[model samples]
Target chain A: MRTTIMPSVRILIFFTILTGILYPVGITFVALGIFPYQANGSMVERNGRVVGSELIGQGFTGDRYFHPRPSAIAYDPVPSGGSNWGPTDARMADSVAARRDAFIRKNGVPGDVVVPKEMLFASGSGVDPHISPDAALLQMERVAAARGFDTQKSDALKELVMRCIEPPQYALFGEPRINVLSLNLALDALEKGYPPPF
Target chain B: MITVSELIQLMLYALALFLLTPPLGKLMAMVFRGERTFLTPALGWLERVAYRVSGIDPDKAMDWKGYLWSLLSFNAFGFAVVFLLQFFQSSLPFNPQQLPDVSWHLAFNTAVSFMTNTNWQSYAGEVTLSYLVQMLGLTVQNFVSAATGIAVLLALVRGIAGRSTGSIGNFWADLTRSIVYLLLPLSIILSLFLVSEGVVQTFSGSRTVTTLEGVQQTIPLGPAASQVAIKQLGTNGGGFFNMNSAYPHENPTPFSNFLQMLSILLIPSALVYMFGAMVNARRHAWVVWGVMFFLFAAGVTLSLWSEYTVNAVTGVGGGMEGKETRFGVANSILWSVATTAASNGSVNSMHDSFSPLSGTVAMMNIMLGEIIFGGVGAGLYGMMIFIILTVFIAGLMVGRTPEYLGKKIESFEVRMAAIAMLLPSAGILLFTALASVADAGLAGLNNQGPHGFSEILYAFASTAGNNGSAFAGLTANTPFYNTLLGINMLIGRFGVIVPMLAIAGSLAQKKITPLSSGTFPTDTFLFGVLLTGTMLIVGALTFIPAQVLGPVAEHFLMLNGKVF
Candidate 1:
């Protein structure tokens, strides 16, 4: 027992230093050297001021910008979580109903048309950064109206939104999504010429 | 109303898994046998250096008792180190977040969880653990604990193959080789892929940025892709972010999501084939794999149907509330079933938001002993336990001594197998019952009535099964849950492992008997059905009452438009 214990403890300590410290540090350097932009949170900038991470959702309430999915945690990164509300939970039902009503009133969409599920439901991570391309398109008219664009500009804006549509990775994995942060950053870029957010 | 595209995706996933299993299994068998492989030249030096530095005689086998002692002591040391690290986290390097020391109970729970390969987090990672602890303390355990599982399984395999030998293979050798040859190389490739797909891998602190709405938001960053790789590949599912895989940074693109999902089942599923090659029972291995595949397919189908069916509350056809829209309904439901079945418990969607029937399927997958494709090496040994019981029952019906793979079913082996089988079930039931009635337990309940009961039930079930996914509704950070769950994780992991080793010890000492006309063929379709039936019966008999009190009742209540 003693023989096993001493060697096992020593090995544990050795592996801890190897895996815990050296491995991650090694990986960190490689990632930084090769994929620096992504490895460092993929932050988008405008006029030398950092705006938001491309990976996380931002609170975009103005009709001029397409909103991200409803965040259950108010988009807080430090303590990210889901609402964890069951479909049958009364509070969840109430919140969904409230979100649906708000979506109809604010977006001025016809009630008869089925609102996309992403528009009505709070995402798993209150910090979901994407809305489906269809969801984004539904709010396109409102975003164009908010920006005070003419028909020609609105058509170009729609083209810009189409560019923001990320195809399903591998052509079969996830759904097509428009990053709200990127789209809104593009909206800012339209007003002032700047490189588009990645 | 399952879409053709969803069916295609499922078919692709199954096809990919089938195609990948044999070569991986062959490579693993080579590793375990200390033979030459493609990776030997690259990783062989590390294996030799590990043994030399630790003074472990790679050729020296130990009796089952010695193996168990080494396993237990090593894990104990790991637990102590992790506990101490959390207590003194404020002083640790890489804590750019300036996190405080973890409370005593949480430190205890976290320590036991990682050491046991449970990875059940009561607190969010970025907020609680320093990067030092996440990497050194938790991530290190992710590799070693998973290696420990594979090590034990190797010992068991040696025991089955031995002829009157008292010694199983060296635990140290098995553990070292598993990490050096298998886990390390796989993790490096997977991590690089994940980083390419934009999963964050950095040492920088959280970045505060101004949003389009003009609100200041802080985005957390760290060495996430590195941890995410091993976390999924090793079947240790601790998440860097609190939202787990649902966080875009941790599982950014659909390609990343698909890769992570595939890696979860890769090792465990391959291990079944490895077992067959080791014991010279390739046919038997495929039969067992077939049984596991059937169960996995059934689970995925049930979850998909339930998720797509109309719910009474919203009067909606699809249950998409807690699912990530990028993964959509099919991917989320598929991920939920795969994660649960493999005991790789990182969720791309919240299980708590799943409709009752879907939630029930998730719970049932864990309750079925997580052997559809369980965590790393643990799943195969666990399924073997059920197989022993099936053979034992068959012996009684035939009025003859039962044999499996040419080994006679002895009293001692049967008793030890029973202990291995029952201990986790006991932990799940007793702890859940106690928590249901206790004030300390009730304090953490986030929902009312049946769903609340389901949360409590899911916690213990996850802990006991060593499947770390949670209902996510329960606030398990309190002292009561931390200590109780800590103990539960230990019992669930080691309690079963000890008896399994004992069975291995007993079997190793017995001489192999020749097969007869009535040896009860384990490779037959009837035996597969019988083995699966034994698993279902044990699970149903033990957990149906609790399931009724929780998800089962919740299902019926939801039909009546009742919300808990």
Candidate 2:
């Protein structure tokens, strides 16, 4: 005689709801209450409108702001990606050559602007938020020309970029990289807009 | 010589983590076990209502077939969800700004990366994912998928330990309670702690901040603290910020860094205790943990010794090529040990910057098959299987039947253990040889020395160990690598996992052999010698040829200043 202990279908749904819906929702809710700002993607807001999330990279073409590494995603948020391009892939080599050429043309920068490897190569995810200050300075000339400002104004902007460059972590964890999204946003605010909150 | 401060900091981190993790991990273990405590009762009640409405089995202990079906089907569903999110993120609601469709390769990479727990993300978290995608898809999957692995491992452990038992714990129950009571509560606490340390936890859009130098910048923001909590707790090493824990928004202070470190190891370290508890021999867990801790300490000592020597004395201008000065020697060594100690791939210090001998130690840790306090669910089972094999070998010496924790070790059990051990070794060697022979792998080499050979060896070891951290010097991730390492991770993780479960199933049916005069002494010093020999002879010998070609040759080349 085999006695049966069949789990009720009701119990299965019950467990699913508990595990799937209620659990995640509950954690999210608690997170929202305690740290409302970061709970919502660590976004910063001005004038009651959403801007961008602080943790993500953004498009930066404006000269006033420091430029991020060239991205394959072109700053696309969904479907984040990397080049996944190997060193010897002909296509990867062509892309690098094209980027180097474009870099030369933009600021009439020398054939050797001493571009950072990160700047030359697309980031693994392609949406990198930081750029080397050297990469930023290379762009400083063009931004000043576009704005009809003197080199001093650009130098000031460069100083601003310098201010934003986060020091190597605890003085040794990684190389210094300037957060592009942050730098550009500050540039926008610096030109007779509301001063950014430090 | 290893500095006293560096060693002290590492141990203090370990002790603090040890003290804090157990209660939280025990709670999580119990949650996974179907004990309704804290948040579980309410969640269970809600589940009851849903089950009644949907006519589903909330209590069914899914048989192997059913379990496999549910797992695969659900995973497929996750793939679809992520794909759909990528394709439709712009059109989707809650996206403040418009972004375009995802490229095909990146989407595939993200899908597999998350599903595999490699979480080797190429995308920046704040820029790419919409709030909805992060919340509804990635975050949700992060919790559930993690719970799923823990549930599966727990079931197999029960099967192995049980005598003549046909039942493993119910998967649905295990998954349900584990998330409700374990992952959620711990995440909440961990997230709050991080938030207090100034890690962002907001929905407000990006803010422009004027620095003291009067420069303005917009800081990108998102739901970082929440993801960071689960990423570490689950041993899934996805970073919300591209720089990982080094990101200011995610790891704002030293306190946050400590907490992040603690979260990554909480479960893995505690499972030693859990295994001890489950097997009814507390000493078994302690002994395993003891051996792992000592071995882990030794690896750290060697790696740090190599690193400091290079930094303080290297005549070469590029010795510490890409290290962050802020992290310095202490943090760098600490991260090396932490990343090696567990299978978590998240790294604060770049392994590429590691000196020659230090890099070898880091690589060697993975070569040991991650039995030194390894992955979240897979780690303990890995070590336990080794113990079973050790006992069997002891039995060979005594000419008596081997028994472990009361269960008799038979020929069938030993075969399964052998299969588990052989599978990963074969996967690595065959794949390494294939890669070494292939032009695709050879083309990726940049360092014009023997160190370059080590890059290939490290790649295979990382994949086979199921540790996601990389040397980064090797430019892997092309179709050649993506495909090869993908298969390696699949085989290395599931290949060993399935065999371990099979051993469990075999042992479960065997009669308990009581201790008698004929029984071999397992806990004695004789067994220790045999076990150490097995680790060296079997484990060491398997990768020796590969190591010689990669690191040893590279070492000679670096010394001679020429390529062979």
Candidate 3:
């Protein structure tokens, strides 16, 4: 027992310093050195003021901006989470129906066009940065109309949406999606006649 | 209903696993054998320094009792440090968030969870733990607890491979080698990659940013990438944040998601091959690996089918509730099965929102004891227990004595294996029953009816299997859950470990018998089938009634458009 206790305590202290203190702190240095922009939470800036992280979505309820997915925590990164609504839960159905109706009313889409499920459901991370391409496309007309874009400008905006569409990583992983924060930022840049954000 | 592109991605994942298994397994085998490797030039000095500072004589071997004593005492010390740190976190440095100290029961539960490698998080991490406590208490335990599992497995492997040798191995040496050689290098690489994918790694406080919509958003930032890497690689599964891998900063890109999923099973899968290399039974290792992969693929397939199908009750196509848009259905289902199968319970999506049968598959994966790739070191040993039982049963049918890896499988070995198998099963069922009947447990549920019942059963199954992913709907931070689940984590972890170590000791003393015609062959395809059948039968028999009450009933109720 004495043999076990002495070595156990010593080793625990040693590893605590090595793994707990050194390893993470060491990675911090490496990350800051190699990927400073990313390691610093990938914060996007506008006119030298920080707006939001490029990887984290912001709640976009205004008609002028393309909305991200429904957020359970209203896109709060501080305590991110999903609705965790079971598929069989009545509340889940109610929520989805409510979101669907809101999507149709807000976007003013034709009754024949079905809203994407991604637009209706709350994302797993309330701050999920990206939305499906279809979800993004569905909101493009609403965004264009709210910004008072004519047919030609709306066509240009559609082209910008296409440009903002990100392919899957290495073209073989995940789904093709668009980052809402980056896209909206790009939209602002285009409206200001400035260079695109990305 | 799976698309061609989704099917292609799944195939690519399988190919990556198949391709990477042997080399990583070989590297681990070399590390355990104390052979010179490519990493020896750089890491050898650190290993020596570790041994010298701790007064651990690398050459001094320990019998099973000595090894177990060392392991328990070390883990006990670890638990104290974690618990104490949580209590004093408000005064601790690096708490930029200025979070308050944890409650006593939650602290106790967390300490036990991490030390046991269960990582059943009762509290949301971003809201609770200081950076110092997260790093020193939880992250340190992540590395050591995982190394501890590997160490125990190495000891058992030595027992099987030894020729009447009393000593299994030195606990300190095995633990050190596992960390220094395998876990550390992989973590460094993966953490760096995760950072490049936008996982934050800094010593800063949460930043307040005003969005384009003119709303203030608090963005949580820390040395998250480093912890996220090890949490996956070590199969520890505790999230730095509440949403775990689902959070954008924790898993920033599709590439990061793919890699994190790969890392979850990488160590556990490679350890199967390490067991082969150590025991000089390559074919037998392949047999065990085959059984694990078969079950794992089946779970993924079932989950994909269920998740992709339209929900009857909710009238939603693709069951996208609680799933990220980037991952969609296929990637999310793949992660659900992989995380559960590996006992790496970091979720990219919430299980509570999964279609009924998909949730059932995830629950069943844990309830099968997580032996489908399982946790680092723990998975293989758990599988070995089932193998021993299978051999015993087969021997009985054939009217011959059972033998495995050239050693006779006698009554004592079989008894230890049975105890190892029964303890977790009994803990899961009995605790679930208690939680169901108790007001304290019933109050924690987020959904009503059968789905609510699943939240309790899944909580116990997750804790008892030492798989930490939750339904997330079970508000499990109360004193009642914290204490009971904490106790169950111990019962799940040590209950299997203590008996397995005893079996190693007994097996180490037994003389090896040469294989004969009468001896049952355990390294063949037939044996793999038999082993798979035995595991399913045992798991199904014990948990079927519980399953019928929870996920199965929910599935049927769901089909009839009855929403709870």
Query: Which lDDT tens digits does candidate 2 get at residues B1-564?
Result: 444544555777768766865576566556555566676555666445543554446566544445544544555556566667766787887565444655555555555556656565544565666665665556665676666667666766676567676556565566555565567777878878877656666555555554222344456566667777887887777777655665556665445766777777777888777666665666655666777777777887776665555222222322222332223356656676676667666666456445666667777777777777776776777776678888887888778778887788888778877887888788878887887779998886645444566667777777777676766556664677766776677677667766666666566566666668887665554555566567757767787777777665544444444332
List TM-scores of chain B, every candidate. Answer: 0.99, 0.88, 0.99
Q: Which portions of model 3 show Cα errors greater than 4 Å? A: none
User: Residues B1-564, candidate 1, lDDT per residue (tens digit)?
Assistant: 666666777888999999999999998999999999988888788888887888888898799999999998999899999999999999888899899999999999999999998899887998999998899899999999999999989998988999999888999999999998888889888998899888999888888887778898988899999899999998889899998999988988778888999999999999999999999999999999999999999988888888887777776766567777778888888888888887778999899989887888888888777889798998998888899899999999999998878888789889988888788888988999899999999999878878999999999989888889999999999999999888888888987799889888888888899988888988989989998899888888988898898888887888777865
Candidate 3, TM-score of its B chain? 0.99
The TM-score between candidate 2 and the true structure equals 0.73
lDDT of 2 at B530: 62
Local accuracy of candidate 2 as per-residue lDDT tens digits, A1-198: 011113323333343344334544565566677666655545555556556655456666655445666666566534344443322233444565677777778767888565554555555334445666677768767766776666666666777778877764454333465666677666666654457444
Give the winner by lDDT: 1 or 2.
1
User: What does the lDDT read for residue A114 in candidate 3?
Assistant: 79
Worst 10 residues of 3 chain B by lDDT: B310-319
Q: Which 10-residue window in model 3 chain A sums to the lowest lDDT?
A: A189-198
Task: Considering the true interface contacts (CA pairs under 8 Å between chains A and B), give the fraction that model 3 also has.
Answer: 0.88
What interface RMSD, in Å and to 1 decimal, does model 2 have? Answer: 8.5
Q: Model 1 segments beyond 4 Å from truth?
A: A192-198
